[model samples]
Target: MKRYLFIMSLIALLGACAKKEGKFDRADGTAAITVASLENHLKILASDAFMGRMPFTEGEQKTIAYLQEQFKNLGLESGNGSSYLQEVPMVEITTTAAPVMEVKSAKKKFTLEGLKDYVIWTQRTDPTTEVKDTELVFAGFGIVAPEYNWNDYEGLDVKDKVVVVLVNDPGFGAEDVSLFKGNTMTYYGRWTYKFEEAARQGARGILIIHDDVPAGYGFWVVQNSWNASKLYLDTRGKDLYFSAFTGWVSQPAAKKLFEEAGIDWASTVSAARKPGFKAVPMKLSITTSLVVKAKYDKSHNVIGKITGAKQPDEYIIYSTHWDHLGIGKPDEKGDTIYNGALDNASGTAGMLELIKAFKNMENKPNRTVVFLAVTAEEQGLYGSEYYAQNPVYPREKTVANINMDGINPYGRMKDIVVVGIGQSDLEDYLDAEAKAVGRYTSPEPNPVAGYYFRSDHFNFAKVGIPALYTNTGIDHHEKGADYGKQLQDEYVSKYYHKPSDEYDTSRWNLEGAAEDLQLLFNVGKKLAFETSWPQWKKGSEFKSTREQYMPKVN
Candidate 1:
């Protein structure tokens, strides 16, 4: 009897050990995120049949349907209360015809070729809009930020006149540490901010001078994006305030115009960087006309949610833009479709895979996790901007947003780049998770690019939500930073925003993307269960907005 009892006790101990190992196995959940599955999804989504997944067309219908079907299969509830689609009303305007802009001065009359020397478009809805003899004023940066105590429009009455402005802020252009966060771009540096400020100043026209460094991308990106039809959110049929004509002038053209006014172009740019700099009238008048075609339609934002076990009203949002530049002017290779494989198709697929992972979790979250695939990101983040304004989940209840825009397809990395680092407590959470996997986080190498303000998360961040946007780092585990940077440079120069952005299985190693997805999944999982709210960092511009919406309580 003693021998039998001892044998039974030994078997019991072995069984207990087995149970513990199984319970703690990380693969149990991570297995749900497979590189093969992600590849398959990308193959279908990025295929030419989807017509580049542009919103408000046959392509949009197919894309949204696929998202809805997948979300339904995962048993996720519709985020829009019984509907997976959120209608985003938009206005599409195509410039049917625009002639070369003619600038007249007493010294000489100059004619600049449209689409070559300058690209211009209007925000007004009128079928025919013309600017005749509009006096051009050279505004420093077209910035008026009260917080920074900077106002470029200080001593200038730009009413009914045209304003020529620099692309980025004075601080960014000069790299001066004392100016507006130094090399890091503030909201005042964004082109959108410049346009809005121009309108507020009652300027009839606005032109931005393009330089590669300050603008982050080459002139080709601006030329291509601005040459096509533009889309904007249609807000309740209200007349939106926009300049008569908004445009970008090639660097050469801007220099020629400044020289025509007997001003040293280089010296003027230098002076613009100084405080108390006054606007310089170019003493030239521009005349331009446009014939436009306008159409109004509704695009859709695909939304799905998993309700929590406890605080269902509170929400953690995962967002990615699903739209790309549709069929447009052909590239050199004659490929017209912008497949957008890396730009956002990777992000969209990652979102779906993440949804699957969360659904397969051992236990449901304690607060709701909402998956949002927005539209019109390529057209100035319209879909997200609309959703931020009319949120399916109340802004006050919305806890945080983890946005994935571009996922690295290359191999694993030793570090990750936080696009907008030092903005919120979310960075601490990300660092903790990254450290667990023997990795670390770094600030974006090119802060002057204003990439933080460029992605879809900016809309959520604008409303005080702690939004996180990180990218794969340049420091590759095996190849090092040089190889990683080479790949990134190649993508930007050869494929970014072009039809060549299709996926190449041979080149893509999705291990890094899977790791990123896992990190994001863990972050959202923690936020879903915790009662603590992540606050924006002390000096962050968004801190006051957070305080207003979610006031700290003792």
Candidate 2:
């Protein structure tokens, strides 16, 4: 009997030592990711049958079911207490444009054609949204940041007025590192923020002047993206605090308006950067009409979990947005489905692939890992926003979030792009994993684009959870940097958000995506087992929120 007990003790010791060695410390790549498997998943999720996976549509039902099935197949438990789905109520608004925006200046009148000179939409739930000759005030930058002691609306009541604002902030133009985090675009620089701030300031409408350098993309991107049906979380009669109209104008249109007002465009741009800059009334009124068709319904956030062996309540989240633009206006070739293959179907597949990797582990993690596929990312990140507000897991017990969106489909990269690189200690974790694969981590080439605030991870970050958002590197291993840049530029011009975004197996290199998935997996794997909570870097906007919500280590 004593001999039998000794043998059992010996077996237990070996198991404990094996666990310490790390179940994820395998050199074989198959355990983490595989190219063929990833490609197979992508083919189905981004196929035409999915119909672009639009929220509140049949595509959404198919997407949610497929995700749930994938999770169940992987043997992962439902994240939301025996239910893999979290219902998110949403409102869809399709605004029909009037083709022309009539501007009545004090001197004369001019008309700007839609899809050519400007694009307009409305967030208000009202069926008819019309701005009839509303006063146009050139609210320089339209920012009211007290940290910089700058208020463009000072002594200017923009209530019932249309505020024409510049895209991005003055710091980006001046390259003054002392002002507004230098060339790095802050939340204030985002167009979404501008519209929200305008609403808060009681503005009837907000129009952003689009310049390539400041807006990071061409006017065509704005035109194509805005000329569609938009989705938002249903406020359920709650005050949404949104402007009647939020839109953009071409640089030429903006210049024409400024010229008509006798305000030198160049001088106004320079003066807008100066301290104590005040709002200038352009003596112009914008007139436009919008007819909106609205629908309210419930969407789902598919959540699955690998509950921790020790701390079941504490969680580390892996997220990807699943919904895309759906079927929209047909392109010149008659292709109407916006198969968001790379935009997000790739990310969602990455989440599932990573979950499979974790499930294959010999030893379970100490903290829970939540694999969440959210909806309505194309419609302003509403799905993730709902999850953050009504989280199944308390924010205090949440450890970190690793988000994958628009990963590399080209080829293996020499480096990885870290979006908002200096935001948190999560960078160190990712850097370590990336280096293991002989790849270096670099900050995103275009920090001024504000790509950080544009993804699902931002919603998690906003609630003070440390989140990591990165993309596949721009420097391809064989094609080199110029080739990488050319591919990216081509996508932005020809494919992004268009029906051309459909998946083409011949054009893709799955090995690169597999590499990214492995790197992200390593980051989350380390966080799940480690006893420490990663914190936002000093001076980060979300740092205080982390300090507030994270459980005290006393």
Candidate 3:
């Protein structure tokens, strides 16, 4: 009897050990992240052989092929009807330099170089466009916000005239906290909105004065972008609305324009802030013409979906921008390819991994999981904007959008930066998942730069869907925050918006990346199963939109 009991006890002990091992095994119902798999994807996506993955180029074809192949292998269904690619209509606008941009003031005249001190471009469909001697009006901020009861163009007729405006808004310089959040930029401050509003007001031309802090990047960024071929959605379907000429003026050039009008440039800006401010006529006129060739082409937004068994209609989305700055002028090293490895390729790879993990799960999620790699994000979130406007899944059914833009190539940090914090309950999900891996959430380091409005996720947020755009934490384990800041500074100064942003495995540490991916997965899994739909926190601009679409749960 004693011998029999000993044998049974030994067998039981062995069984317990096997169960423990199985609990931790990724292939056996465990949540294990394969960093090697992620690295392999990034290496291929960011490779020089990929030719920088620019839209409308050879690189775009290669990149899309690889993505489709991976999705097929992973067993995800095509998101579009009978296809993985969603065709997006685009118009490539290539403008040639006119003789010069002639500016005539009361007593002086100035000629601005085409691509040197100033860069001008337009999106109007007109083949032959000219702004001949339009009056210049200095409109402070050039914003009209019903919420704030502020309008710079309240009583001015800006039709067929040039509107010169500040880069950000009056809220940026306001002293009170209740006024536009005091220095935190709202959507009205974005350059896109500025130009769109100007077009709505029937302006002949719109010129924004560039300031480094407010515009986020330096004047060099704008110069580089304007020098390259610009792309926009075809105006054939939608009405094309824009000023005849839309561009930027450097600080000194703007000051010169103001000085030519015999107006104190600094004092005039100060005076424009008060109530009942009128448009200041600089007594100046801008004369410019453009010879533009319009070519309509089709781009794509790649989408793959894993349909849920119980709740096939409800969905959680994982998105990243696949497009980067296409081939452009060579850099100092004579390399014309902008690899955009960290800028977005890393984030794209992360989304691929998340898709794989969801596909591998034994107990399938309750809601469908959608992975979208959008095009033309580098051009200003155009692809995602189009998706938001025309969604494959209903906006009311989209539970949440987890967007990854620039992932950390460096090692792990303590706190992950959450852009547009305090906007949604999605942060609660992220906080719990991150704590599981000894990580925490933090707000954006530079809120004043308006990083929240700079990415594709902003489009979804605009339509009332709760969106989370989180970057790798900054408090590194080895080098701490200072070291992390150093890496960021290097990227911003040297490779950002340049051709040197190619991938290098020697410097990249994807451990932190894998951690963040796991955290995002956990968030999606929770949302997929939960009964309640996540809502924007009170006071958020998207709150009303969310309330309108969310299902009434009694």
**TM-score, model 3 to reference:** 0.87
Instruction: For residues 1-554, write the lDDT of model 3, one tens digit per residue.
Output: 99999999989877755542311122322254567888898889888888888878898899899999999998899999889998778888887657678999767778877766677787865687888888999988888776567788998899979999989877676776466666777777888888888998988888899989768789998887774567887768676667887888888888988888888987888876665677887799978888788898888899999887667899898889987876778988899888888878888888888888877775566678899999999887888988888899999989999999988888788878888777799998898777876788888777677777889889899899999988767788888876776787788888787887877778788888887788788888777666578888865667777777776645
Estimate TM-scores for all models.
Answer: 0.87, 0.86, 0.87
In model 2, which regions exceed 4 Å deviation? 1-32, 96-119, 129-135, 146-149, 154-156, 224-227, 250-265, 281-289, 328-336, 479-483, 500-503, 539-541, 544-554
Model 1 alpha-carbon drift over 4 Å, by segment: 1-31, 96-113, 155-157, 217-221, 225-227, 255-267, 281-284, 328-337, 552-554
Worst ten in a row by lDDT for model 1: 19-28
lDDT string for model 2 (1-554, tens) is 99999999999989876774444453432365788778888889999999999988899999999999999999999998889999999887898878898889777888988878888888777778888989898999998776577788899888889999999987886768768778899877888878888999989998899999878888987977765767788887676577888889889988998998888999887888888887888888888888888888999999999888777788999999999988988999999999999989999888888998888776787789999999988888999999998999988889899998887988888888899988999999989988887988888887888889999999999899999999878888987875666788888888899999978967888888888888888888888777788888865757767777556755
Model 2 is weakest, by summed lDDT over 10 consecutive residues, at 21-30
Candidate 1 at 445: error in angstroms?
3.2
Clashing pairs in 1: none
Residue 376 of model 2, lDDT score: 88
Candidate 1 per-residue C-alpha lDDT over 325-435 given as tens digits, one digit per residue, 9 for 90 to 100:
778879999999999999889999999999999888766677899999999999899999999988999988998999989898898988888987778899888898889
RMSD of 3: 6.3
